[model samples]
Target: MNQQPVEGFSKLSKQRKIDWLIKEYLSDDRSYEQILQQYWNGDAILQKLHEEFSENTISNFYMPYGIAPNFLIDGKLLALPMAVEESSVVAAASKAAKFWIDKGGFKTTIINTKKLGHTHFIINVEPHKLQHFFNFKLKKRLFEATEEITKNMRNRGGGILNIRLIDKTADLENYFQLKASFDTVDSMGANFINSCLEQFGKTLTEEVAKDETFTPEEKDSLQIVMNILSNFTPDCIVRAEVSCKIEDLKDDSGISNEEFATKFKRAVTIAEIEPFRATTHNKGIMNGVDAVVIATGNDFRATEACAHAYAAKDGKYTSLTHCTIDGGVFRFWIDLPISVGVVGGLTNLHPLVKFSLALLGKPSAQELMSILAVSGLAQNFAAIRSLVTTGIQKGHMKMHLLNILNQLGATEEEKNHFVTYFKDKTVTHHEVISQFNSLRAQ
Candidate 1:
């Protein structure tokens, strides 16, 4: 394939970049530019703000920002803001929330709030000497060096909690790490943690050079590789759970309450033991998680990486959610490990992010964590409930009806007709198109 490269693309103006794209790759079709411009913010200042959010911005891409109401978490009712492109996610969450609310609503607990970062380096030294030095001399220096960067965080009752020197010479000769734990409180703290880690690297090099206990060659042997914060925050966890008597599980499924509970547990067990099933099961869970995460302007990519890693932490891929039936009560829950922020980054700049935070009642980071976990749990319940009864497509395809209708170029009157026709019928792309074409013939 021949690839086209642009010269000084980032330096190009918005209009010029679109022109270049049309002339070079879009067959010089001006309609493409019009389509891109259609999504751009009408306000000049807001459009400029969006452009600077990323580099080489040609135009804006839009996702439907939806709200799922009736979420009762820890005795608090919340209407979650979700930004997603996929169909049926918000509807599923809302339906699940309403179902659980009738029983007693969802409950959540904050297990911990500790995030992690590391300073990776290699130093030629005996293990004992490095350990003794880190304990007696270098450890205090690391804290003192990062005081400036962590001052505001500490004032907020969150900051660097602990640091230690870890030797990994057995795995790789002279490879070591300074593993640190943090309490970032309300912010995702990537920048804050990375800033402190970089300072630690700087302090480690500077202090080692000044110490007379180390020989010149030993000092020179110290090489700092990098300082970074890990997205996989296993220790920072929140648990969301819902429980109800089996009798309450009785619904329109036509199955006995006991039978519904049994099948739901069995479906979860399949996902737990089967890798092929677990992948799709977890994707359904993230349909809820990533939506809320994106709506709040947090990093969905990081959240996904961490959640999947945690799922496979036991050396096999499995489900993030769990379920059990005991003493005639059915319980379902998920202990999700994720770090999010109610402030900073895009929360401070993006208008919708700010609006989302407010819509969520301006929750603290801990509250937000619980909300996200509950979103995932609620979505999973809705999925399993559907799967064990009417099947996944019944609801998903119905929600997807509009997309099919639009693709077939149905008018508003036809749309209303088809929607009513498909209300009690199966909705498939082929069937929808076929029915519309027959209507056109009539």
Candidate 2:
């Protein structure tokens, strides 16, 4: 059982009490009509997008959406946070973070973003002569031709910084691919890199024409080919750190908390090396991250891919976050690619997304990442607490009662009774149905 704040609940009228329960538990402030609009309009748009991109199979992207509470992002209060469901994720992170917050708040630092550009060039020539074509002369010419491509970005407070070349390699037997990376500042690098490639392709064609060092036949052999975007971005990084003490984890449980901490550390360490373990390990981190990503309307898939890739970047699967215990304080640090944007995409179109962003007080990209990292740590706390104590099912089942109440169309009185019944561990759909029937008989 949980104690209700006397002034908070007792002073509220019946309707106010119900409204508060709905707001806090459901994390939705929309009226009945507005809620209806979300499901109805959302279903329609999803259907259309699904049909249009039938081959794309957007439905494969389904993940349960839930909200995290008690979060302050960059000093701004936020309620009704959104997150995707993965088992033990929310509980672990939330609890982990709350432990730290009990001592002192988690602190974060973010680096300025340098956008990445992908330039794809497809050239057809003799496979044996490929090595001859990749000379220093060609590298200098490529750089000089693309120099003017930075003009527009420089004008708008962004500029091209650097580029790197990549070679074709065989993957899974006989597939060959070419890619290159470039850095753009401020602007998303796709358009900028594409523009550079378009101009460079022209330059290469003109160079081939002027080079009389080769016969027309030999010139035909040197095909200046397709140039396009690569996934390479310049240097930009974000860093975050959190600290907490074991005293913060003390709960009603009389079990050995110190023993639990030692065990928990070993478990987290296991998550570092094994790919199978790393998936669930990082999933916990993303529980908090995906919510902010969805709320801000940035691309979640890109964020997910980059994060997971970064986790395994050093030729070993490791935790994207680090954990340690120092004296009395437990410390955590996480650094990952959080390439998220504040403006653009479905976030600009969806009504609820707009409302959610407004609820957040319109945070900047850096502030958003900082808070998100905090939430990830918090959620990690929530998970470990459950694993160490009474197990995850208990609290989750308690919270899940609200969903059951909604399903039964329970009235205010019924909702109170429903929650009480849940506390007794006897609540069931059958019991709820019987209670409904009994009330009807009344």
Candidate 3:
């Protein structure tokens, strides 16, 4: 491998960068160049827009944008778009949607929609003195100072909800946090919350400088570390659940409904107590969550980080969802904190996102939260049901059969024949390749 660095790489034209990359690293491979070109949108304008989505854009990387229809969420049918490369995710979600639709659908409720931001600072002043200064008068003044920044949000009935002082001397010397909560309404409010916090930080610095109760040394010790919004939004939570009679859970797998529910509940309990299981357990939940989040043009990374942080909020990693059978009814639900927005970022910029929102009837932020949470819950149920019944691979590997066939370069006839052949038999990569090779020999 050559270790030489290419100077002015970012300044190179798009084609130049592509040329340089191919010549430098790919040994001038035209096939790889063609592969990149093959995925570019035929429309030049759209392709350019995609290229500009980020810097040094050589080409577009794509995931299959699929639709999982028949989601009966909150008494409405929705077709959710999922952007994922995995084989069985969309299939499993679709199965879950269809199963739950006949079981009275998924019910969801938004517990709250308040996002959080903080202005972290260190102060050498007495704790009591700082608390007294953060009283009603100072708090009101702080809110008033950010009025310009929050005016539009305020007019829309969303703005700074509360501000409080948190003492952290036990954790660090002279450390304190000005925790602020906001109602961003339909937008994720990252920029809005950050702007407000920065303004608050400036106001706090000025106010502390002028406070007669604070000596010169104390004023100098008051230092702002950072001001930013928190993705771990515990207050912005939603609950989504599905319930049915245990008898209604009967399936073609020959497992009794009672036994099915018991195994499912036990599976959830193991995730709750075991850290290793909980990591993968929550990842399965996010496969559903991140897909919907990406489809709707929300920040999937932020949502993922927040959801996992919420999972470990109890100081031990655990499941984000729970299953229970009560009074002859089998219920599964997830109460997780997910911060998402429907009005900003890529939601407004991407064409597919607009379509995805329209497919969901253009839900508000709270409604989007409910729908996302339900997607996770439904995915979990489908997974647990599969695990407890015929085992995970029966369905997963079946869904994966197409990928194997395609990879083996099976023609349409071979694919159709082998798809039917593998329907009743187990499928593996080696088996598919061997069968394909044998068929080709014939």
For residues 1-442, write the lDDT of model 3, one tens digit per residue. 4746899999999889888888888877878888888888999998887877789888888889999999999889998889899889998999999988888899998899989999999999899989999994568889899999999999998999999999999999999999999999999999999999999899999999998989999999989999999998998999999899998986767878888889889999999999999998889899999999988988888999999999988899899999889999998899979999899888887888999998889999999999899888878888888887888988998888889888877789988999899989988878888888888898
| Backbone atom clashes (below 3 Å) for every candidate | 0, 27, 0
Q: Model 2 Cα displacement at 429 (Å)?
A: 7.8
lDDT digits (tens) for residues 6-33 of candidate 2: 4656556534654655566555454643
Considering TM-score, which of the candidate structures 1 and 3 is the better prediction for this target? 1
Residue-by-residue lDDT tens digits, candidate 1, 135-218:
999999999999999999999999999998998999999999999999998999999999999999999999899999999999
lDDT of each: 0.94, 0.59, 0.90
Q: Name the 10 consecutive residues with the lowest summed lDDT in model 2.
A: 169-178
Runs in model 2 with CA error above 4 Å? 1-80, 83-99, 122-152, 169-190, 193-236, 248-253, 346-361, 405-413, 424-442
For candidate 1, the clash count comes to 0
Candidate 3 — which residues are off by over 4 angstroms? Answer: none
Cα error, residue 74 of model 3, in Å, equals 1.5
Worst 10 residues of 3 by lDDT: 135-144
> What is the lDDT, from 0 to 100, of the residue 399 in candidate 3?
88
